[model samples]
Target chain A: MADASYPDGLLYHPEHDWAQIDGETATFGITWFAQDALGEVVFFDPPQVGVQVTQGESYAEVESVKAVSDVIAPLSGEIVEVNADLADAPERINDDPYGEGWMVKVKLADAGEQQGLMDAAAYQAQLG
Target chain B: MVAAPSDTLRRTALFDRHVAAGARLVPFAGWEMPVQYAGVRAEHLAVRARAGVFDVSHMGEVETRGPGALAFLQRMLSNDVSQIAVGGAQYSVLCREDGGVLDDLFTYRLADDRFLTVTNAANHAKDLAWLRAHADGFDVQLADRLDDYAMLAVQGPAARELLAPLADGPLPARFHTAELTVAGVPALVCGTGYTGEDGVELLCAPAGAPAIWDAVLAAGVVPAGLAARDTLRLEACFHLYGNDLMESRGPIEAGLGWCCKEATGFVGAEAVAAARAAGPAERLVPFAFTGPGIPRQGNAVVGGGEVTSGTLSPCLGVGVGMAYVPAERAVVATEIEIDVRGKVRPAVVADKPLYRKAA
Candidate 1:
């Protein structure tokens, strides 16, 4: 987590979010850059499963010791699952942002929304 | 979208060192200061358990000199300035004539006819102008020492031990100061700190600060930042200028009556005495969450008060904060509910220090 990483095959949002796509489902989480900027996250108020999420809108809130940041949704979907483990160990967001740190899994409302996201290389370039 | 540059923010003498330490720099009181290095919890724990060094160079200093210095400061400061012996440090508040707190400061008696008062960065300019405007009748000279020195606070149980070897002579005891050569640089080491920990605050020349800072870090002192400083001070129940202490409230209401000597006849003495005799309507008290949820500034209390400062105490592992509530309900065991955002979080008024060292 100390080094900046942007895994390929993951779509990136300008707000520093990532979406890992499956058949019709996708896992969403903030990117390494976002987590690094937020410092050590102490709290993650996860959104409830079965809630609707709109792309470009905040679905959850992440709090560090000194600040609170809004975690935006990268794509529109119906949230099917929330990462309950983060309730007590929000630091995972900084440790494994792409894996266990994934915030929510959603059933995509429109897979076509992926067109708006950037690839890993493009996201890295944006970060630069 | 790209973020805008913080070009207008001022930098301290140790800014480069903070950057090299991978600190999270943030704008504080118009200065680009390190909010945290490593992490707030880590830095906070480091200071509590061992020694931690802080770049407090942003804090301002004012020098009052001349034969009338004592009388002039006695009129301006809320505490009994006449009692501070040479080499002694006294904490006091500057108040408006109407009893509003201007700023909380620590004045060190450097000499019989000279004193140095450290001021909050945000209120330094206003405090300077206020002192200068009132210098008409008094034969005192006020010099702004804001840029003349860089401040570093080495704090914790092992603070003295960590700083001793590099010091040319012995460090000052608590609430005292001594001039010494630290890391080969001339410095005024004051035995004081905001963190309720044993420590010395070093005021050194700007040019020599980087070397001193590096030497302290080299001595195993964890580099802490403003975020850790806030948590540590809050755990100690120390009043933060903008939060716990404010112009809208007098020192008595802010639980600082012990430092206020109305007989000294300082500015706002009459109003403070009146407030003291009659008692303040609201009293600032430290509180901790009985349940979950961190209380934050401006969060409304269920009753007639509001939280002024709050955080998840790194030491206590619980939500702790200070609030101003009706004096009647400020008792230590009184239960209070804070409206955090929209949800009500249960809390109880605790002792002055919400966190204490384990026995």
Candidate 2:
């Protein structure tokens, strides 16, 4: 009975990508807004842990009960960790998206990339 | 901004209208169709409570005219077409050689020997080709009416009130048709709908459909899009052609055995009978989530067998969906789990069409 609606604490991209930064490393996943749009998440095709991803580039695929959607990366970086947990529990993105639903952690090429991304409030305004 | 590649998306005459209304258009069955005008759940609830209009012009309309039309259709569709008297419409399915469903369609008996078969929009070309291939030497003339007309469905409890001003009279009493003029546009109004509500479908000239649609909207009919249509159909437990029943499964497995006639020798009759005799491997049944997460399509169905179409039922207040499970697991109240996000959330089997708002 967890809300699948939007959650704060993560920056969002119009395409549903989100970025959470800790120093040079940034964790990324689809926002709750994206999960809500996708309905129910059933499967996730994640990129490898060491794969390099660019800002605004699609690096993963998520399948819902309705159709397949792409999961993009928010900031250019090398993927430090891929949320293996999502491979089995994709609904975590729908349940606690900003928390456990984190899809990947990246070693950022540029920490300034976060500034270009929309904050939670700005992303919510974009949705409106 | 650069536009998306112009895919061969066949659109209805109301395409411009939908776009102007800010509809999110997606490709559905080779057509650039609207998935949602506003949102899925909102439009869905609008139709359930108020009046909603749907531009179902994408659905194919094929006429079986000439002297032997009824007889030809009798052998073509699964439901008893003979029972559909003139001016009445009946819902039926066109089956394949193996008794598998090619498409679920609506048969309208226009006259003594002239009938119209309204099929799914995506299957228009395919259905026409299949019908033509099977229709050889039958004294019946099959003409694809796809280009000649536009179809609009006005659905909900207040549908009658909203459309009566546009029509010649009240809704033609459940599947019955009435020749009428809406917004000065001539149309055929039939009391039939996919949403399982008391509604009517108006068929008229492609250009005239928009006028009628606008007038009906002016009369308080809400313009609903494909998102509402889908959820409404799902809640009604109405079977979707490509999602629920396809060439891979039959009426038996889809829990549509009631429509299969024993006396009729229609196309795929043999296969249907054989399948019935042998018993189906799986059955389509409704399942609701007892746990947190929602279950979606293609997600593994555990404790049953195979999973089919799945989605979150906003009305159910929990995750409700459908799957092809073993006969034993398909039973009402049977407990199972939908493999959502790799976690198996417990669910209970319920009857199809989880939401029914009367007839």
Largest TM-score belongs to which candidate? 1
**Angstrom error at residue B121, model 1:** 0.8
lDDT of 2 at A60: 82
**Reference-based lDDT, residue B16, model 1:** 93
- How does the DockQ of candidate 1 come out? 0.42
Cα RMSD of all models vs. native, in order, equals 1.9, 6.6
Interface RMSD against the true structure, candidate 1 = 3.4
Distance from true location, Cα of B48 in model 1, Å: 0.9
Error of 1 at B160 (Å): 0.4
TM per candidate = 0.95, 0.80
Q: In model 2, what are the clashing residue pairs, if there are any?
A: A65-B297, A88-B341, A88-B342, A89-B341, A90-B341, B237-B353
Candidate 2 displacement at residue B99 in angstroms: 1.0
lDDT of 1 by residue, B1-359 (tens): 22354889999999899989998788889899998888898999999999999999999999999999999999999999999999999999999998999999999999999999999999999999999988889999999999998999999999999899999999999999999999999999999999999999999899999989999999999999999999999999999999999999999999999999999999999999999999999999999998767778899989789999998899887788999999999999999999987779999999977888877
The TM-score that candidate 2 achieves is: 0.80
Q: Could you give the TM-score of chain B for each candidate, in order?
A: 0.99, 0.95
Candidate 2 clashes: the total is: 6
